[model samples]
Target: MTVWDRPEPPARPVPLDRERIVAAAVALADEGGLEAVSLRKVAARLEAGPMRLYGYIAVKEELLDLMVDEVYAEILPEERAGDWRAALGGLAHRTRRAALRHPWLADLLGGRPALGPNGLAVTEATLAALDGLADVDTVMRAVETVSAYFTGAIRREVAELRAERVSGLSKREWQRASGPHVTAMLATGRFPALARAVHDGADGDPEVSFTTGLDWVLDAVATRLTRASP
Candidate 1:
């Protein structure tokens, strides 16, 4: 057959792997949130048939697990913090930063066990940081408490950030924009503490607030450890 007539070599299928699948899933999630992600959608983004992704990820849930683990890879610290307090604090901040970058993550963070290697590493680091600081049950509780705190906090932060984006108002501005309502409420005198807070401008910098609360929680964990010690 003439060169033109010869059947063209089949284009090699774009290499498919778990990493690429997860990356595509993350991109979709970043752009449209977790609910926007699906196996077919991710496959379309990767320019592959949905079936191709099945080889890499068994189901949509597995893809989500991979996406979360990928973020954990970013959250992992390069060097261990000097102490348990520092270690836990560093992880919390890193997690917050990650959630900010991928706000959709708040929906999945701590929603399910990671099971992936990177997720396992993050858990290991957290647990190891508290090793020898307390008994097994106490350490587990401390880890759970810290994780629960940060996950919930990050979700709130992201929600507020999105609200501000939609309303085009910062938190303080939103509160003040309701001045008429607030003023009327204050006149009622029933919400005295809240009225005083509004008048006093009780809201502090969000970052400062977050850090301060985190430190308090860490201190509580320390108290638990101290109580558990010999």
Candidate 2:
């Protein structure tokens, strides 16, 4: 066939779907943080128009919900731990891992209800772990309390990690840098506790710090659960 007469091959369909769109959005976020992700950028990455994404995701909020749930899928334990403490601990650690893997998740954690299937399943698994251990209210409180601890902890940890990276110094080193008001403030007798922590307290590894805090929270929850059970 002549060049103009040649049969035009059919146009390839842009395989637009929720999963693909979400994956693109996640990749964008992983590279440049959540604020970097947008329908236009995601669509561009997929070689489709922004409007095409709306069919799968009504708005950016829905996209964020999907992203958070996607991380929840990672947080779910492969097998339920034998006991409630183990189960909650496993879930909390897994969640921390997920947030570390996708720091953007820290921004969304607990910001909204997790109504997606995977997110709901995570809740179900968490509740199941505490089942029969306490009254419904106590069990609910235990879950919320532990969740609140980890979510806030992870956000703080990620913030510190970002700051450390930007400053090119570990947290302890940053605190130890002499002069510039911080040292002067520490020298003031009014802040004895703060000065002691900065000079004498060990700056533990982040993971160790996270696990220690988690264990403390779990211990508190255990007391409540035990009191309420049987």
lDDT of 2 at 59: 70
RMSD over all Cα atoms, model 1:
7.8
Among these predictions, the greatest lDDT belongs to: 2
Instruction: Return the clash pairs for model 2, or none.
Output: none
| Clash tally for model 2 | 0
Q: Candidate 2: lDDT of 44?
A: 95
lDDT of 2 at 175: 61
Query: RMSD for each model, in Å, please?
Result: 7.8, 8.0
The Cα local distance difference test for each model comes to: 0.82, 0.83
* Candidate 1 Cα outliers beyond 4 Å, as residue runs: 1-12
Looking at candidate 2, what is the lDDT of residue 218? 94
At residue 167, what lDDT does model 1 achieve? Answer: 99
Among all candidates shown, the one with the greatest TM-score: 1
